[model samples]
Target: MSRPGSPVCTPDWLALREPADHTARACDLADRLADRLGAWPGARDVVVRDLGCGTGSMGRWLAPRLARPQRWVLQDRDADLARRAAAATPVPATAVVGDLADLDTLAGTDVLVCSALLDLLTAPDVERLARLCADAGCAALLTLSVTGAVALDPVDPLDDDVTAAFDAHQRRDGLLGPDAPDVAAAAFARHGYAVHRGPSPWRLGPADAALAEEWLRGRVDAACAQEPALVGSAERFLARRLDALGAGGLHAEVGHADLLALPGTVR
Candidate 1:
């Protein structure tokens, strides 16, 4: 479930920066998901529903490679993003403006894809979704969740406290709270979907200067918003990190899980 009125809470910095820079990382994660599932032996056409399909990033990455023509349904509450995603999709695709609670609107999809979305939902919501997917017999791909840890190049003492607080903030049950990958995996397991988890971290450095900067700014902004206590320090910390990146980009570890589950599979 999305936070009440928080659907639009997408940090401005992330909205502006992540689109292009995150493409490579998204593609790599998608490839890993595709390889894990391979071809579903019984399925002829693969129908994929990208839940929380922000600008159809996952669709852009995953559609071209399928042997069978893929039908993609990009679902998000944001109409503008839905329109943009519909326009960009290479395969047969449609966009739906609806919340995750309206996931029932989704039907007959072979794959249920939710990238960077699970972390935004509550645990119960995640479980409900898992059960729905199992009933529909759709495989799932959930990606790019914050693991609540940031490894700095020159380790900052405050790094641990800040990240931990941020993680706590993420897990807070305000409207939607933050549902981690572990919770999601367990939900899938309970629903009888064999779950496969892969950690795909965002590998950044000076080579990815633009993306790194965007990520840094977004991280700081999000951290501050989630934990207002850090607001005063976040900007300065973000600046320091950005400066270090000018010399050599910092490796920001973003913990992500690629969950692949088949219907009726046991733990």
Candidate 2:
């Protein structure tokens, strides 16, 4: 569900950061996923479902790295996004526009994957997801869930305030926000899934000035929205941050985590 102040994650935004997402993701986790899939019985092909599949970036990045002849289901609530995603996918992919909670749609899928999606979910929502995956006996690779830590070179005094507020805004409607990785790990663990986590932070530098600026703008906007009192300080901080970025004196590490959960053998 789209939050009130949450960024809409448009096709443009997804396209712009697709490379960064791919670069930041943990390749070792993907290898681990391949190893787990190798253990699955039978010679049948794999059914991979990408939830909240904005522009199908996840599929584009993950498909070629794994075994071939895979079927990809690009699922999203937005029809336009789903269509564009399906079109951009390198492999044979079908677009399904529906809620992620619809477990029937996920039935028969070997792996359920999502990117930048877990943090937007509430505790109950995440629990339901974990339960569904567990019941279906599918592995899950949920990537890019924010960790609520931002390290910026030439830091400003208001950095912490803005980050804290942005995180608050993320968790506004009971969403897990920065705490999602841990929460999801626990949820999957409760269902007997072995969860592995690794850092997948975005390291933005001078070459990524545009992306860095846009990201900073979003952070500042979210912070001001969460705490109106931070408006004045936010403006100043943003100005300084942007100036430093333009001069190649700014670098940022936006924290995120990649999670791979393998469901235990269903008794």
Candidate 3:
């Protein structure tokens, strides 16, 4: 279920409609993850199960780097997305249409991957998922969870409040209650999975004016709608930032945590 005023789960926002170059920017982040984690012995020859695999973005980013052949299973609740993802993914990829609640269906994967998805699940759901992955002996990589702040310029007095409200909006659904990255990492650690954490922040500037604008629009829309009191203030703030962007440009920080977990403790 989606949270009130949350943009993450919206169909259009979730869709793979970003400009090719913009999409590449996002994909580049995943590529960095592959480089960082692929060195582990367990990562090779592993079957990757991508949960909430929207348009096969993760697959597109990670497939080329594997030394051994990888079997990527792209799973999502949207059948159309699954179909499209299957079509778009490189060879050696499969698509499954289902929800995360069906842990039984997730069996047989060596590695579990979910990008920008943990923040959408409840605590129980996360716990259940960690246990399931542990049972399957699957290493997991979960990424791109929002940290709830975007610094386009110098900080303002209301920045903290805006970010707090947005975080509340993300957790209001009760299912995914807050910084899911942190929660999921802890759950995995408890289940005996040694997890390494990394940060992937989208640092936008004049070079990324277009992508920055798109992200800003989505973020402002969600923030204002979630807290009506911030509507006017958000607009004013966005206007000033956009103007600044015309010259000095603005930087919106899209903070995410990259988690790498294995079956055994790191030696």
Q: Taking the candidates one at a time, how many backbone clashes does each contain?
A: 1, 0, 4
Compose the digit string of candidate 2's lDDT tens values, residues 104-136.
535698899999999988899899999888878
TM-score of each: 0.82, 0.95, 0.81
Identify the superior model by lDDT, candidate 1 or candidate 2.
2
Give me candidate 1's TM-score against the actual structure.
Answer: 0.82
Against the reference, the lDDT scores of all candidates come to 0.68, 0.87, 0.69
Worst 10-residue lDDT window for candidate 2 reads: 1-10
Error of 1 at 174 (Å): 5.2
Off by over 4 Å in 3: 1-45, 175-178, 265-267
lDDT tens string, model 1, 1-267? 344324443545345545532542445546655654564565456788888887776777667756565788888888777777788899888888887777673468778886677777887788888888887777787767655545667776568756766666666664233347788888989887777766656666566677778666766765677788887777778777878888784666555555666666321
RMSD of each: 3.8, 2.2, 4.4
Flag regions of model 2 displaced more than 4 Å: 1-7
**How many clashing residue pairs are found in candidate 1?**
1
* Model number with the top lDDT: 2
Rank candidates by lDDT, best first: 2, 3, 1
Q: Please say which candidate is ahead in TM-score: 2 or 3.
A: 2
